[model samples]
Target: MHGPHVVVVMGVAGTGKTTVGPLVAEALGVPYAEGDAFHPPRNIAKMTAGHPLDDEDRWPWLDAIGRWAHERAGYGGVVSCSALKRAYRDRLRAAAPGVVFLHLTGDRELIGERMSQRKGHFMPETLLDSQFATLQPLAEDERGVAVDVSGSPHEIAERAVAALRAA
Candidate 1:
């Protein structure tokens, strides 16, 4: 039996983590946290100014998201994060061992197109290249599944829930 399911919906900027995370949480009857919300003003400012965050800039933000996962471990919850690198995911796992990642993935062109269509978001489409460059896919040993984002948001969420169960 599983202890609790802490799902982190992760991907590069345009993969729809924020869009699908809440639906997954709703389906699972768990609390939802937007990983972007964990970012400090400085980080947000940096990103808004078109600066990609270095590891130093990311540590505290990841720690905060990890803390949230740790706090909600027993009951389970879902959070959206880029978790783009293996090290970043490892940092998160240090906080909640059972945390599972749902990685949304797609081609750069498609993602860039989606990002371009987005409105009022702090992250600019200009950063999509940086995001893709930074993304280190979940390894074979990692406890995660990658779902393609070619479908609608609802469909993507359904696929995520299914993948989580299958995992």
Candidate 2:
């Protein structure tokens, strides 16, 4: 928190990473990027058809986000990425060594309900299980914090900010 840091707001679908990421960035006076926007049309189409993305399907998207994080290295920025695996996070860190993660954690039931309520999102509730299955929580060595996603977006963002500051 002493200097500029790129924070990746990461979680499974429906975790509100998109909503909370910008708020976190604003609170820290930084820019925000939507992870979904980096995905190619084919990737979006696959997900929209209810197929989960494989590692190969995600590499380019991850790389794009990583590049964005690398560009914001000296100037802080926030971005929403699923970052479900440690390898994905590693790829990001390789691009931007100072990148930190803000992982949103929540129960499947709550997240599924949220996903179902959301409109126009490519990701479907059917893929929630695959998301959770692929998720690997941050390791002790990782520079990140996991926040419970059981509150208002403002409250969640506040918690993320406090935790990131503490980190």
Candidate 3:
């Protein structure tokens, strides 16, 4: 919040990263990018077929998002990414230093319910467990904040903005 920085809105599937990311970007007066758009066709096909992506399948997608974040460095931007592992976040940070994270978190039942209600998303609800299993919460050394996903997208985005400001 002190200066322009790229913020990665991160979380497991159905935690509303996509829904809340744009609102956070709007509140911060920055451009927003959908992390899913960086995914290659094969990745989408695998996920649509109900398969969880391995590290190999994710590196390229993460790199693509990282490139965009690097381009937005110091200019401010927000992007939604299911950065489910510490290694993935580290990789992104390596590509775009000073990148901050906004982690969206919620209980499994709530997230599963949200996934069930969603339509046309390639990530199936069946993959939710794998997503949770892979998630690595932000560490103390990380420049980030975790916001609970327990309300409307706007409310969650407001919380994200406040948390980022405080961070």
The per-model lDDT (C-alpha) reads 0.92, 0.96, 0.96
Cα displacement (Å) at residue 45, model 3: 0.1
What ranking emerges by lDDT with the best candidate at the front?
2, 3, 1
Candidate 3, residue 79: the lDDT equals 94
Off by more than 4 A, model 3: none
Clashing pairs in 3: none
lDDT of 3 by residue, 1-167 (tens): 67899999999999999899999999999999999999999999999999999999999999999999999998999999999899999999999998999999999999999999999999999999999999999999999999999999999999999999998
Model 3, residue 82: displacement in angstroms?
0.7
lDDT, candidate 2, 23-128, per-residue tens = 9999999999999999999999999999999999999999999999999999999999999999999999999999999999999999999999999888999999
Provide the TM-score for each candidate, comma-separated. 0.97, 0.99, 0.99
Candidate 3 Cα lDDT to native = 0.96
Native-referenced Cα lDDT, model 2: 0.96
